[model samples]
Target chain A: MSSEYDTTETLDVKGQSCPMPIVKTKQAIDGLEAGNVLEVVATDSGSISDIQGWADGTDGVELLEQVEGDDLYTHYVKKTE
Target chain B: MSTDNPTTSVDDADSEVDAAELQALRERVEELEASMAAVDDGDDQQKMTIVATQGSFDMAYPPLILASTAAAFGWEVIVFHTFWGLDILHEEKSQDLKLSAVGNPNMPMPNALAALPGMDAMATKMMQKKIDENGTATIEELIDVSLESGVDLQACQMTIELMEYDEDDFYDGVTTGVGAATAIQHMAESDVQLLV
Candidate 1:
């Protein structure tokens, strides 16, 4: 079930290439409040690793859960202190 | 269109032609010289480089697409694959790549719809065919183009070991070794650093 802490944000980078998804996600996270959560949806599978790396690279965000299924990889990340 | 030395040379021995013909020849010579100078101004070429490390199926397209296009500009390009990015290097290319429906909120179908019987299998097959036709080149093609364009290929030893991969695990030009600091220093000197 979706909870208050679980908010969804979709990023359509279909026609676009790689790094773009990561870059767009970075911009999306930047616009949110600290501690706020974001659920990113991307057509590019690269976004999965890209987002994970982005969070690790930033060192301030937290990757709460990564639900990987056959075709989708729904990731949950929270903005942290 | 002034000629520095407008002299009829020995090569112009046919100067005995009528004055009208001589005048026309001079005008043609002047026009040719002017066009030559204009051509010289447009001959210089600009250069650029792109480094793509992401190797997932969907991730793979970014590097291949960017590399092929950037190379089209006649710019020097180098694609480095390390860690999971090495998925593009998987021998069983089919298993190495996936269109990735996981976490893909933008996917048109809901989880139930996606899982509606054997739809998932069909979707995966469809995506593969689309990418393949759309120039989602195979790992072999990726490595070949990089070689033809003089792309320097570097692999991360740490990542390789962590993933329990070996030399046979990589392709021809790949050299096994290089860490993050190295990538940073290298990219810092590049015109573009594209992390897929």
Candidate 2:
């Protein structure tokens, strides 16, 4: 369902909760080169706002979009630095 | 000769006005540069300081959760575990921290029933079960995340001495025996401060 941006990596945090979604997202983005996009799949409902708020406050990363499926949340993050 | 004097004065006044405008523009550019640099350095990084004063099973989550979350946000986070809060950083104590139902109003049972001999154990077990069922991060897991994310975990010196806790009792990477003065200094310098 994600076709807008070419995702460089996909991080599966489907069952992780709270800080793990964001923490794992950060780690994934860190390993990526600048301009690379990361796709995050999560089951935690809080990841919607958590990833948004995290991207809003953090530098060198941009949250492109969030796709909500039947039971999963997909977040597209771009490493801007 | 009179014409020459007027022309000379006008030219002189025009040059003086230009010099004043140039100086003002220069000062404005310097001010803008300084603020831009501040934004690059100071505004980019924020600091948070928290004083954790409780050690119950329920109470332990807030500090660690907030600390790890803040660290994820790229903020410098410091959590000072004082008094009963020191139990959270204690390797053995943290794993076995109990939920006391005796004085807790949140418990559904009557205070009398909650004060029964085995109530604390039952409550602790119930909460642990809930945490497991929900897939929530355990206290130990949160501690690991906080450390891995570079959150500064500090233990109160006075509490360690009063409780006769060995310095080795705390988890690795925790800054043990930190004085109140150090905690206060961090709080003063932090952009956000909390006591929980």
> What DockQ does model 2 achieve?
0.64
Give the CA lDDT, 0 to 100, for residue B129 in model 1. 79
Each model's TM-score, in the order given?
Answer: 0.48, 0.86
Expressed as tens digits, the lDDT of each residue in A1-81 for candidate 1 is 243455755444444435445544555666777777777655566667766766764545787876666655556778675
User: What DockQ values do the models have?
Assistant: 0.02, 0.64
Could you tell me how far off, in angstroms, the CA of residue A46 lies in candidate 1 after the best superposition? 24
Worst 10 residues of 2 chain B by lDDT: B1-10
Clashes of 2: 0
TM-score (chain B) of candidate 2: 0.82
The candidate maximizing lDDT is 2
Model 1 stretches astray by more than 4 angstroms: A1-81, B1-53, B93-95, B113-121, B133-136
Model 1 Cα lDDT, one tens digit per residue, B1-196 = 3553456553355555656697998999999999987785444223333445565566766675566445433445666667667666545552646555545676777876765566555666777777565434555665565555555666676777887877676666666677677677767666677777
Across residues B76-145, which tens digit of lDDT does each residue of candidate 2 receive?
9999999999999999999999999888988989999998999999999999998887778999999999
